[model samples]
Each structure stands twice: as structure tokens, then as C-alpha cells.
Target: MISSIFFYSTAFVLFLIGLFGVLTRKNIIKILVSLSITETAVNLFLVTVGYIKNGKAPILTNTIGSIGMNNLKFVDPLPQALVLTAIVIGLGTTALSLVIAIKLYKNYGTLNITKMGGKR
Candidate 1:
């Protein structure tokens, strides 16, 4: 439940920030940074989805005299899978955005996005 709340809250905040950047920011770099923040927040939420409360490692150990194998809670596999996917996606997004930012910076010769292609 806590994870759910955190995930949603972080996502929402990131969304708002991204929207703000999209709506109000003139600089492409600032917009890109905001986009990255949103992406990171989403990735964070995705990775957090894999967390298991009180979950034990997936390693197997010899059973004790009377204990059964049923009580142990193995790490949840779903979250781990999701995290991996999110990581890949995040990397792709970062690379793509960085490339775009570089292009814009090179063309404009300045980091200020509003000034980009100003004389164009």
C-alpha cells in the first residue's frame, strides 16, 4: 500500500513538473531536464514495484529439522522483471533526449533554449 502511494505520488509530481516545463519553459534544455525528471520518476516507480516487504532472498537453503519450505517468502519476480524493462527504457529515453539536446545546443551555440534558432 505504501509503495502504491509512493509510486502514484512520485508519478504525479513528475507529471506536473513535466507539464510545467512543457507549458511554461522556453528553453529546450530545461524542457529536456524536466522530461528526464519525469522519466526518472516513472522509472523509480517501476523499480519500486519490484520491492517485496520482508521477502527473503531467492537462494535455497537446507531445511531445518522441523521447518517446512512453505513459510519462506521468496523475492517477488514481477517487480524485478519490471525494473529491468524500465531501466532499458530509461536508458533509451536518456540517450535519445541527450542526442536531441546536443543537436539543439550545437545549432544554437547556447544552452538557453529560447535563444535557439532565435534569428531563424
Candidate 2:
């Protein structure tokens, strides 16, 4: 079985990479992409928070024969639900940001953030 530590570390690494991209990139689209990456990493981290070793699905089935908590090791579903909502919201925001980026490019004739400033 894979350790929870692995999932955590992977999420952390993805977050750091996204952070680096957001800080270092000068293009508006690239920044938005990095922001999306960061969002994905956060979602991943949230999902990992509900991880349980040898956990079964949260759904109750008769095969298990008991509804008692003591006999079940079900993974928490809250984080998964939250992540699902976040994914939808993130998609909307990403699309909106892309539209804004298009407008910025049209107005400035450039996608580079630094270059968007008025000519010196």
C-alpha cells in the first residue's frame, strides 16, 4: 500500500512548482496557468487530508453487515465533495481569467505583464 506521506509530498511539490511559475513568469497567461496549477495542488492536498489506510468507500453496503462505525474504515467524503466544487469554480475562474488576458493583450498589444505598462 502507498503511504499517505507520498501523496502529501507530491502535492507540496506541485504547489511549490506552481508558486515558482507564478512568481517568475512575466506573461499574463502563464501566470493564470500557474494559478490554475496552484489550485489543483490545493485540491490534491485537500483530498489527501481525508486519506485512510485500507479505507473503503463511504457508501454503506449490506455486504459489510454492519452500520456501526467501529466495524467500518470509511474514507471521509467531505473533502472529496469540497474538491469537486472547487474544481467547478476553478474552471469558471480560469476561463474568466483567460478572457481577461485576451482583453489585456488586445489593449496592450503584448502578453508580457511588464511590457503592458506605458512606454517610458
Candidate 3:
């Protein structure tokens, strides 16, 4: 229980920090970084949910389970599937964010969104 608490607490802290950055930061690059952080935290939390003691790989073959101890448990496939989709979507979002950031930098000469209207 202590390990579980620590793990979830860390995850919560990461998520909170990201949320704070996204909500309070003015820099466009900072916002993008924060968004990426939020994605990572969420993914980590999701993967944690599927964790099991003495977890074994999810293989359908009979050979794998033959030698397995009684305590061995298969990892939940749902979390794996969700994590994979999150990875793909995260990649797409990161690529698109970079492209947008590049375009913004080229236009404004700086990453600050507060000065987006042009220099004073």
C-alpha cells in the first residue's frame, strides 16, 4: 500500500504541475512543454493502473503459462492498448505543436505569446 500511495502521489504531482503551467504560463513554448508533460503524466497513470504483482506477459500460447508459478498474473491488455494509442496520439500532437511553434517563432521572432501582436 505504501508503494502504491507513493506512485500515485508522484503521478498526481506531475499532473498538477503540468496543469498549473498550462493555465498560468504566457510563453507559447512553455505552454507546449507543459502540454507534453500533461500527456506523459496521464500515460504514466494509465500504465500504472494495469500493474500487477508478479505480472507476466500477455501471451495466449500454452507454452508460456506451463512454467508459470501460481502467483503469476497476466498484465491487463486494456492498459497496453490505451498506452499504445496514447503514444501514437502523443507523437502526432508533439509534431503538430513543433510545427506550430516553428511557424510562430518565424513570424514573431520570439516564443512569448504576450508579445504576439509585435514588439513595442
Q: Which one wins on lDDT?
A: 2
TM-score per candidate: 0.66, 0.90, 0.83
lDDT of 1 by residue, 1-120 (tens): 465677768877887887788678877767777877777777666655665767666667775323567777767677667777877887898789889878877777876765665466
Tens digit of per-residue lDDT, candidate 2, span 18-115? 99999999989889989999999999999989989999988878876566768789889999999999999999999999999988877889999888
RMSD of 1: 3.6
Off by over 4 Å in 3: 60-63, 68-71, 118-120
Q: Which sections of candidate 1 miss by over 4 Å? A: 1-4, 59-67, 117-120
TM-score of 3: 0.83
Provide backbone clash counts, one per model.
1, 0, 0
Question: What do the candidate models score in CA lDDT, each in turn?
Answer: 0.72, 0.91, 0.83
Worst lDDT run of 10 residues, candidate 3, spans 1-10
After superposition, the stretches of candidate 2 with alpha carbons farther than 4 Å from their true spots are 66-69
Clashing pairs in 1: 50-79
C-alpha positional error of residue 113 in candidate 3 after TM-score superposition, expressed in Å:
0.6
Q: Summarize candidate 3's per-residue lDDT along 1-120 as a digit string, tens digits.
A: 345556667788889999999999998878988988888888888877887756677776677657665645887879889999998999999899989999988988988887888454
Clashing pairs in 2: none
